[model samples]
Structure formats: C-alpha cells, structure tokens
Target chain A: MDLNTVKERAGPREFSPADDLPREYREAATRMIEFHANSEIMGAYLERPFIRQAPSIDRKLAFSAKVQDEIGHGQLLYRAAESLGVKTREEMLDDLANGDGKFLNCFHYPLKSWVEIPMISFFVDGAAMRRQATLRRTSWEPYAHAMDKVCFEEGFHVKHGEDILKELMTGSRAEQQRTQEAFEEWWPRIIQFFGPTDDKSTHHDFAASVGLKQQSNDELRDAFLDQYIPKARKHGLEIPDEPRIRERDDGTYAVEEGDLDWDEFFTIAKNDYEPGLGQINGRKQAQEAVQWVRETIEDDATTAGGHAPQAAD
Target chain B: MAALENPADLDEREREALETLLKRLADDEFVLAERYTEWQVRAPSLESDLALANNAQDELGHARLWYDVLEDLGFEEQELVYERDPADFRHATLVELPFEEGDWADAVLRSYLYDAAEELRLEALEDSSYPKIADRVGKIQSEEAYHLEHAQNWVERLADGEEGHQRLQDALDRLFPHALTLFEPVDPDVETDIVDLGLRDATLEELGEEWLSIVVPYLESLELELPVSSQVDDDTFEITEEMLPEKRGRDGSHTDAWADLHDELTHTYRDLGRSETTKIMEKPE
Candidate 1:
C-alpha cells in the first residue's frame, strides 16, 4: 500500500494473476506468511548453538544480538500477517509445531560456521531484504508497514555481515581458508534461497491473491544472482559452478536456469515441514527444551489471574 | 584510567554500602540485560527488536561501568561477577525470572518495572558520600530516564487503549511482586553506620520505604495496584541475597534460566580462549 507493487512487477516482467484472486489470494497469503514466520523462528535454533561456542567476547556479543534479531523479526512479521487477518501468531506457531507448514528454503537446511552468521546476513539477509523491501510497498497496509521496519534493520545486519566476510577474505591466508570453508558450507543453500522456480506451483495463486508475495521464484532468484555474484567473487570466493553462474566483463552474473538446483530447493522446502530428523522428532525436541518454561508461564499466568492460551491452536 | 583517581572517599558505612549496592546494581542490570537479549531476533518487528537490543546493550554498559568501580575498589571483576555463589548475590527476585520468548508485553513490563525501581535507587545514590559514583550515577540516571520514558510511553499507550490496557495490567500484576521485592532491605546495620558518618543519606530499610512512597503514587494514578511490602517482611517481597548461591547473581540464587541464559550468552566468548585477545568493538569511524 505504501510503495508501488504493480509498477515494479510489470516493469520487471508480467505474470498472470490467478483468476478470481479474492479467495485464492487470501488462502495462499496465509500460508506464505506462516512460512516466513516459521523461517524467522527456526532461524534462531540453527544459529543459536554457535553463540555459546563463539570464541571471543565480540563473537558472543555479536551472535547474541544476531539471534535475538532473528527471533525478533519473526515476532514482527507474524504480527503483521496477523494484522492482515491471515493467521494469528499463536495459530501460526501451532501450524508450524504441529500442523504442516513450510518456512523458507534456507532455514530447513543446516547452518555451520561463524562466517555463515554474516553470510546469512550478507547473502541470505540480502536476498531476504529484496523480498522485504518490495513488500515495503506491499498492497496490504500492515505487511507493507512491517516490511519498512524489517528492511531498515536488515540493512545493518547485511553491512555487519559483509564487513565480517570482507575482513575474513582480506585477512591472513588462514582467514582465507576459514572464509572459504564458511562459503562452501552455505553456498548450496544460498543458491536455493530464491526458492524453487515454478510458474503454477500449488501455492502460487494463493500467495498472489492474498498479497503474500509479488515476485515469482525465478524473478527473485534472478535478482539475487544479479546482485550477489560480483560481491561473492570480489573476495575470491568461488561460485563453484561457472555454467550455473553467468559472468560478464561488464561485471555482473546471471543464474542459468538449467544449472539452478531445484532438487536441493525442494528437498529443503519439503524439509521445512519435516526437518531432517523428521518434524515429529524435531517437534518433540523443541517442545521438550521449552516445556518447563511453558509450564512456568502457564502456572504463573493462572495464579496471576491471567493465562496465555496453551492449546496447540 | 582510574582518573577519578581519588580514594572512593566513602566512610566505612558508605564504602560498605558501595560494595553491596554496586553488585546489586551490576547483577540486576546484567541478568535482565541478558534475558532481554533473547528477544533480539524474535521481537515482533525489527525496529522494536533493534530498540530493545540497544536497551539491552545499554544495561550491559551500565553493568560494566558499575563493575569497573568494583574493580577499582580492589575486587577482581571476574570473581565479583561470575564466581560468587548465588546466596551471596544482593539482587532482588525480579531480575531472575524466566522470560516467555515472544511476549513483547512481558518484556515491556519487565522494562517498566525495572526502570521505575532503577530510577528510584539511582536517585537515592545521587547524593551519597561516594562522589565518583555519584557523578557516574548522575550521568547514568539521564540515560536511564530515557529508558524509563520509553517504557512509560509503551505502558501508557498500551494501557490507555481498549483491551490493550488489560494485557499490560496482567503483566504488571505478574511482575510487580518481584519489582516490589527489588526494593527490600540490603544491609541492616549500614543505615546507622552510614547516616552517622554522612556516607549514606538513609538506612537501607528507610530507603526502601522512601522508594515505596515515591513510586506508589504514580502507579496509583495509572489505576494499578502496588505490591504490598514493608521492610524485612516486605509483603510482596521475599527474595534476598541469602537465597542465591552466593555468587554472580545477587546473593547468587538462580533458576535453571541462568544456565540456559549463560550458555547462549557466553557461546561466542567461550571459544575465544582467555590467552587470545579479540577486538570487542569496531572503530567508530
């Protein structure tokens, strides 16, 4: 509602809006917002293990701040989606923890390395920012307003992440190896971050009708590839697949469709619901870790004359 | 740079109060700051998240300064901060409770209650025999005033609007008991010792009572109930230094929350072995 969504999409290219969008759009928007919310929440679990293991005061401080930001963002976006009447935050989590729900392609995958913190901030947050910035002009008032805030913060995270990567790349030879290992670990998933490119995927129409997502998968992936390739290479970080990454003397790169890895993308997306140990096991583990705190909140709430809802829904 | 180099200039009573007060200040600020950091990535939105994180950082900075003063008084910072058993901690029960991860209102309530008590305590310290600390407290008070104002803004905004006020009222009811406990007695004998020497302006219990009078009126105006409390048997207050394990937390008693918190908190630092020095901050540029 704030920015021009129709103009941007048309300028980039045209795609058919699902016919009779009023109903379908709302359904898909609910699902998409839930997925993004889950991504933000689960993103914490992936990165959290490292904060305790961080090697320095600065690392601890930075990671603490970073994970906190991730969780915080999830809260914000969930509330935004709730404002749109798509889903309640509690319901979204119930769907995530219990019912079938999908997050972004990036989160269901694993994360390793301190370097990945910034890389996620750089590459992933950068990609995330693209989607978010566009959402800043989203047709839905609440989602658009929320994105404005999300985008501003992501800018800082990206810069901080870039600086970390920049230092590692330009640091000593040992730093180079560390940087490379970090790059290699996250690169495949990063490639999948644009999400699988499908014109008529099952969830597509549902998304557009409700104002959940504007850009097609391929469109966003192309935008990401176009922006990130040079920055990745500037630090001598390899793209790993030359054919997949189009290079130009003019200094930009394009994603070759054939080279794009959809199997990995789908594998990750499917796992967004299932995780790797399976959703059942992952759900059990997450529940156990939080059970005591949950119980405490419930018990205290009752005694205090107010209580938070405990039902999965 | 011990440039504030003069002897901390407290009489025995004030000097003793400094030891108890600063640790209470440090631990209270430190732990709440730690808990608040969990909200960093998961806050309802990035701007709000960033704002809360900045507040967390400010608490940590305040903790570090308080600790610096402790170290200046010849105590080792690490031992003073980490090694003490829970029972030895002087912090109130308010700072120790576990947080519900995504509950922004809970976080806001924590801030509002803590900020109110913090302002009260710092105001009392402003005229203490410890000049250096007084000066430092004065500067911190201003920044903390902003934090309190921020908390008040949210409280009034949330509490004034429809069902919003109920949610805030609920949080206040839950956390207010601990907040009241925050003002309970610290040292029993210090009042006579410090007042006689002009080191402290009032006795610990007296100050607690004074603290109540100042805050209760404002809280009443908001249509909120103040936690019932008196000095030692302070009605709403039950926590004391003797409850903690005698260490880093006030009198050191802590829940399992502290361990989970410390693990997440120290994660990055644990890897950077003590032998290596890592840069803590980037140049301002």
Candidate 2:
C-alpha cells in the first residue's frame, strides 16, 4: 500500500500471458458480455415499433431517445468486448440472428402499447440492472469497466420507465387496466430473465469454470424478487400469483414460491415460442424495406461510382 | 414564435425574413433528424448508433426551437411538422435522401457532408440581423461543432482502415454529387430578401465556398478524394408533391418511408383521438 510499492507495481504490464485464467471465468465473461451486448443490440427490435407506433408525438419522441440510447449501449458494450478475448462481435450477431444467442425474455414478448414500455424499463430493466450489478466486478477487466459505465447511465432508463408506469398505475380506469394487464403479462418473464433454475452443471459449475458468469441465475432472480415484488404489490395491483409468504405457528413469516404462468413464461424463454410473431414479421418487413441501402454498401464496395470522389466531381 | 420574448417592436421585413429563415432552418434540421432516425436501434455499431441518435435529437431539438418561432408566428406545432407536403419542404436533398438500411458508409459520408453544410449555415445565421435567431444559431452551433468533429472522426476512421478506405471511396463516389446539391440555391427572391434583411450573412454560393474550404483540407489530409468540381451534377430523386400520401406531406410527395414515420411518430397521439382529450401531468411552471 505504500507509494513506492505502488509505483513499483505500476508502469506497463511488465510481461504478458502469465496465465490463460480460468476457462470458466473466461467463457462466462464471454457469454455475459455477448449476452449483454446482444441484449442491447436486439433490445431495439422490441422498443422502436412501440415508439414509431405510439399514438402521440410526446410518446413517440420520448421513446425515441431511450431506444437510441439502448442501441448506443450495444455499441459501447460491443467495442468493450472487442477489446476482450471474446468471440468477434460479428460472430456474436450471427449467433443472434441464428437464435443461438438468447436475449432477455422480456424482449422476446411484445409491447402492445406505451404502457408496456414503463413495465419494461422499470420492472424488467430494473431486474436486469440488479443482476448486472453482480457482474460489475467480473474477473474480465473489460466487461467490468463496461458494466461500470453502463450501470451509471441505466438509471435514467429505469426512471423513465417508472415515470411512465406511475402515470398509468394511478391514472384513469383504462390506464389502470392497461397497466395492470401489462404488469401481469410481463412479471413472470421479467422474473424468468434472471434465468432458469440453477442447473448447477452448465449454468453453475461448467459455466463458471469457463467464465460464463460470476453469479448463479437463481440468485439473480432472487435479487429481482427482493427488489421489485414489494414495489409491485405496493401499487395495489395484485401480484398475479399468490403472495409469497413464510408459514409459522408461533412465529410470523417465512418465504414461499408462488406459481408463475409457465405456458406463457417458457413460450418466450424457449426458442420455439414466438410470442411476438407479428412483431418479428413487422421487423423483418422493416428490414427488407431498407435492403436498398445495404445492397448499396455491397454495391459501392464493388464499383468506382460507389466511392466518393474527394475533389468534388 | 413564442411571442418573441416581446413581439410588438418588429418591423414587417424583419418578421418576414424571420419567417422565411425559420422554414429553412426547421426543414433542414427536422428532415436531417428524420433521416438519421433510421439508424435508431439499427446502426452497424452501437457507439455510432448512439451518436446518430444524439445527432438526430440535436436536429429535432433545432427543429423544435424553429417550430417554437412558427408557433409564435401563428402555426400549430404538429401541423407545421406533420402537415407539409413534399414540395413545400425546403430541406437540402442531402438531408431528405433515405439512408439505405445498415448503410454505415452512406450514413458517415452524408453526415460528414451535411454537417459541413450545416456548420456553414449556422455560421451565416450567427451573423444574422435577427437577434434571437442569432442567439439560437450560436447555441445550436456549439452542439453541431461536435457533430462535425464526430462525423469527421468516422470519415477519417473509414478512410484510414483498409476496408474503411475503400468504403469511403465508394461512399464518396455515390454521395458526393448529392453533397454538392446541398448548396442548391433557395428561392432566389427569398434569398435576396433574407440577405438584405441581414438575417443571413452570406449567399448560398458563399456558404458553399465556406464549407468547401474546411472540407477540402480535411478530405485531402485523409487522402480520400472527392469528385471533381466540374463533374458535380444533381441526380437526385427529389421527393415532390406526387410522392406524398393522398393528403399529407408538403406537396404530397413522400416515400412510403415517410408515411411509416408519420404513423409511428403520431400513433400515440392519434390513439388519443383529439389532442385535448388526454392530459399528461403538466410540467410545473
């Protein structure tokens, strides 16, 4: 801790490759980074439609910046990961399109309207951030740094989501109905985002052995329940399942698990479930609509007219 | 537009010049914002995506202030934005062009080229006789200053990387002619009136020349060439009145893209049916 000792330890890395580190640690970081990065990248697919399809200017513009921020966050995380020894970002994305990579279950489902955004940003993103915080000290320096940067900015997103949710949770009857329904639809999936039960094999030991994650999926889910369940109930909206409680004779309370709607839950969690079929189709239509631009890049690469002449022809 | 902070003192030409200047500023900024908005959630890189979103918001913010002026000048904010037909929109062809999806090259080139033009326009406005407009021009200029730098960063990065250099060349070849057209003259009479009123400090050619001065050096430094000045031609598919949907957009000329934008931008509001029917929490005064 002395200054001279600190200085002695400082300066450039004196040498390189002392160790490969743990495979579990390394690979988990890879999965976590790619998972987070992909989440940021594809997160927009679920958001923009709601923004573009918003029934009002204020809502449209409001959603615009948040969606943009997410896409940007994807960029930031990707660049950070690129510096790490993870899979190339291009490969990661290919994995995404192929469905080999999974996004948060919250994104797989649809946002039927603006109310969905509040639930997503607040409840879902709130859960994601809590789980994400556990990774902030990840053995992989790059991911840890990226998470540090991201967690700071994410507060705005959560607050923005909460603001919208609060407006509706207390608003007119239609607004309340819409909010309640959306919350119910989203809770389990959002809960599920902490991920499936700790397999203790692929998810716990092997995953850690390969550096796929620093925390267990169940712990992350528990963190979410710890953080949001009370808030959900406080809104006077019934928690869709029975109140998780502890039974006691002379004592007060103990924790119990409430049933989740699995049919819907796993539908989004498992790849086969296309909860947002119309949305996926809508997105594909949107993508095809802009093919000319992509083709232009490929085309420009092949031709001279494709390159801009600097002198001003 | 917000009653001028104090409106009673303006002369007629001052007001007219202000009005003319506003439409140009708003059209240019709004459409530029819209064009860049395409990259929202979809840019090839997240950093670039965020930057694009940042710039788009900047353009829209610029439009908002101009719209504020129009609202002051007696126009509804939404109508001023959503109702104009294609022919009536005076944004340069550069800002109006649809960005090909995932077209990182075009997006970089267009931003580099248009930001150059915008900086010149802002500089000209900063010297205008309209005091309030000049103040805004100054404030907007601060943000745009970074935009030029950011675009220049991408342009240089593209021009420097092995693949980047080639993409820059192709982007230049395709987008240069369009870039030059960003200097396409405004209504000549309107131009003269604007200059005479001292609301714009320079003519289109002068501003174009001013833009070229900075851009030429930057591009040359990167060894990425541009089209020859003599070969510059306007081959734009200018969206005209015919391009708009049946009833909307200036001159009714808009691509289907515009219609999609309109719906997304207005969906929530439209669901409200009438503007006055719903009320969000009023921001405290």
Candidate 3:
C-alpha cells in the first residue's frame, strides 16, 4: 500500500506480516520492535546473577522464573520484528552483540547488589509496564500480540520485586538504610527510562503518526510517576531530591527534564556507556562460546531434511 | 513393607533413616537446580534457554517438596538451607561441580547422566515405606521424564558431529566418575536402615547398577567410552577407591567449590541478618 494510504489506515492491530506495508512503515516498526527485543535480553542478562545470589530458595526460584520470562519475551519480540522483513533475528542479535543495537538506558548501568534489585525490578519495570500496557494497541499486530503475553507475565515480576522492596524496608536498620541508598542511586535512571521528553524523541512523531507508538514518552513517564511514586513511599523509600518530580494541580506528576542527565542517556542509547559495554561484551562472549552448538544443530537439521530435533514424546 | 502413614509414628531409628533419605533427595534436586540455573541466559539459543530454565524450575520445585517433608520433622528453611553448613549438605559431588564457560556439552551430558540416575532412583522410591515420599514420587517422575528427553535429544544431536562428539566425549570423561557418587552412602548404618525400613525398595548398590546398565549402553551406542569401563564387571558396577573423588558430599565432605557457592547464595540472607526466609508460594501439599 502507498505511504499515505498506510497512514490513513494505521490503527490498533492494523499491520501484520501479510500486510502490504510501505518500506518506511516496515523500517520504523522494525527499529522500535528490535529495540524492545534487545532490551528484554539485556534486562534478563542483568538479572541472571541474582538467580544464584537470592537469599532464599523461593526468592531464587522466583528470580530464575522472572529472568526466564524476560528471555521468553525476547524470543517473542524477535519473531515479531523478523516478521517485518527488514532484518532477521540473527542480524538483530548480532547487531546487539556488536554494540550497534539500542535498548533501555536503565539497563545500561550495573546492578551490584540485592538492594538495588527492586530499583530495576520494581521501579524500572513498573515504568516499562506503564508504557507496555498502552502498546497493546500498537499498529503492529505481532508486536501487540507479544505484548499481550509479556504484560501478563510482567505483573508477577513487578509484584515479586515489590515484595523484595517491602521485605528490605521492613528489616533491620542496616538493611533499610542500604535499600534507601540504592533507591537514591537508581531513582534518576528510573526517571530517564521513558527517555527524553516528547520534544526530544527524534522518531516519536513518525512512530506516533504511523500508530506504532501508542503513547508519547512524556505521557507514559507521567503515568509511571503517578503510580509508582506512592508505591515507593509506601515501602518507606524516600524519593531522591534531584530530577525534581512535581505533582500537578490535577494530581498528575512530571519530572523536571533539566535535572536528568540526557547526555548520559544518549550515550547509553548509542551503546557507548562503559559499564554497559561490559554487559554487551559478556553476553557476546557467551554467544560466541556456544556458536558451535548452534552450528551443530543447524547441520543436523539439514541432514534430517530441515526438521529441528525436538524433545522425544 | 507396609507404608508409614504419619511422620509422628516414626521411632528414633526410623526417623533418622527417613531424614537421611529426605536430605539426599532434597539436596540433590536443590544443588542440581542451582547449577542448572547457570545456563539461564547463556544457552545456545533462546528456545534452548527457555527449555533449560523450565527444567531448572522443575528441579527446584521438587526440592521444595522434599524440603517441605523435612519440615514435618521441625526444620525451617533458614536452618535447612541458608544457615546450614556447606559440608552438611547430602547431595552428590556431581551436582556441585561448576560448569566451564560455554560448555553446552557439559550441561547436556551432565543432565543426561543425572536424569538417567534420577529416573531409576524415583522408581525405587515409588513404593517407599514413608507415605509422603511415595506420594511425591509420581509428580517428580513426570517432570523428570521431560528432563531426560531434553538431555537425550541434545546428547544425540551433539554426538552426531565431529566437534560436538569430541566435546561430548570430554564432558563424559570428566563427569562419569562424579556421577557415580549419586549412590554413595551418606553413612553405612543409615543407608542400611533406609533400605531395611523400606524408605526405598532398592538398595543404593542396586540403583547404581541399574543406572550404569542404562547409561553405559546408551553412551556406547553414541561411540563414547566410559572412563572406568574395566570397573563394570558382570553387570555390577564396582566403584573402587581410586575411582571416587576425595570430596564425597554424602559423607559431609565437599569440593572447595561447594563452600564458595554456598557462601554466595546465602550472602544476601547473612548481609541482611534475616531470621526468616520469604515465601512466595503456598506450601506444597
């Protein structure tokens, strides 16, 4: 279909692999979905260590399950992106390994301890969920379909994270203090999770115009602040003074953009942040190490008339 | 040979035997799950990663069920896991060994060996004198069937190619002896009581022989050699002193890796000075 007609027809679940989408629409949707896919993987990578380091067996099980869910989300999203025909899953994954793929800025920083876990799991995930809930109406049908499952499973992750936060905050003075400190450190990054304001988001206009983006950055950020700020305070965490978030007369919230480090956010967006490079390279090394297995499987598939080996009944 | 219907009915001797058997079952599942989780995001493909993670969670759930049975003896999660001494764990040495990076072969081969033994062990416990143990066996065995299939599928595919075959061979050589520790006695008297009391119908010797009978032929079919083939005589697998690792976990001895792993997993609990463990799921019935 022509670009003008595509724009006119763009709506929730409007586009599918079968659609005769214009190149511009396809490329834009691929970029947006690929970034989402990469973030899921990187987020899983960040939380992988905690599956081992969890304080209790139940917590370990929950963390492992949560991380597993994130990887599953990545798998779904890559397929959605691949359906756009702009790039294959391997190409996107290779791009991620090579540091050309972009993902959420919040994941770029290192998560050092259990105290910091809730900051990512609860607060950052809370923010992502606010945005994701809106994307259930995205123009890309497969992307929206993936979000349906992701949003279903993500509720447990956020609640589990909040459970951790509640436990830490209610514990001894040392535990409470460490948790508060972790909050202060991560609070700004959590605010930047929605990215720069709508004005500064380069692709926002085109994405929104095509109906691929369901909500603007500022709108999503406001929604997140409205919901999570009270939840954080309820858990006894003091919101950091910086990146001043102001409550509007209408009971909504907004972060002062000037207070956030957009320069650093942009650096991370470019995959140039130092700690994030470690995360990317570590995953790359793991991917490279297992290259032989994939090759072996691929060769086996060819020998067996292109059918992948599956679990025995 | 009749089932012991209630935990309250056990005498001190029976209690000790039941506890020993429970600890071995729980510890092996817990430790193997711990090791399996190391492959969470590092598996060769997304599909493989999800499959391995499912197996890990299944093993952990089995561990929780066994530990819950131990709770009837008045033990708590903190006392049983977090604050427990590393050497006190009764898992086999094979479950404690760390995987080398990117060794998908080790992951697959280890699962194959462990799950093969697990199937035989679960079958032996299917008619346990302890009613709780017998009841949980069917649920655990169903999950284990998938684990065994997953491992066998990968092992078969990997063993089909030159590079994959070489990698599988290396893993088999390193892991086969440790796997034998699965049937090692935690204590000779306690093991004897475990069988005499009918906590398990088969003795450890019988389980070990059955395990070897299953895995030995399977490995040979894939053109892989067992490191200690000469030890298998007349269908009875004899584990000589030289074939055993110095650290037999069942005997309260462990490799240095166990201590490090234990310390890391319990770090958050200790750092926060937690007296209670958080529970997210309802206690297994």
Chain B TM-score of every predicted model: 0.76, 0.78, 0.97
Ranked candidates, highest TM-score first: 3, 2, 1
Error of 3 at A121 (Å): 1.3
| Candidate 2 lDDT, B1-285, residue by residue in tens | 223344456667656666767887887787777677777766643445567788888877787677666666677655665444445665555566676555576787888888888888887887666566777787789999888888886676566556667767777776665566555545567677778777777886677666666676677678877543322533322323232223222222444655565555555555534332222324211
Report the error of model 3 at residue A75, Å: 0.5
Residue-level error in angstroms, candidate 3, position A32: 0.4
**What does the interface RMSD come to for each candidate?**
8.4, 6.7, 1.8
| Model 1 chain A: worst 10 consecutive residues (lDDT sum) | A11-20
Model 3 CAPRI quality: medium
DockQ by candidate, in order? 0.17, 0.23, 0.71
Could you give candidate 1's per-residue lDDT for residues A144-249 as a string of tens digits? 6667777787787788778767766775676677668777777767867766555636665545544456777777777777888778988689877523666667
Binned by DockQ into CAPRI classes (incorrect, acceptable, medium, high), candidate 1 is incorrect
Off by over 4 Å in 1: A1-21, A44-90, A137-142, A167-176, A198-216, A235-238, A241-244, A248-250, A255-261, A272-313, B1-24, B38-58, B64-120, B128-132, B135-264, B272-285
Arranged by lDDT, best first: 3, 2, 1
User: Highest lDDT: which candidate?
Assistant: 3
- Per-residue lDDT tens digits for candidate 2, residues A1-313, read 3333322332222111243443434455567667788787567877766655544334545667778767767767776665556577767765665667656667777667776777788887788788667766554556666677688778877877776777667766777887788777766666666655675234565544333356787667666676676677776566765435443474443234345555665565445566644444554555454444444444444564655322110
Ranking of candidates on DockQ, top first:
3, 2, 1
Residue ranges of candidate 3 with Cα displaced over 4 Å: A307-313, B228-234
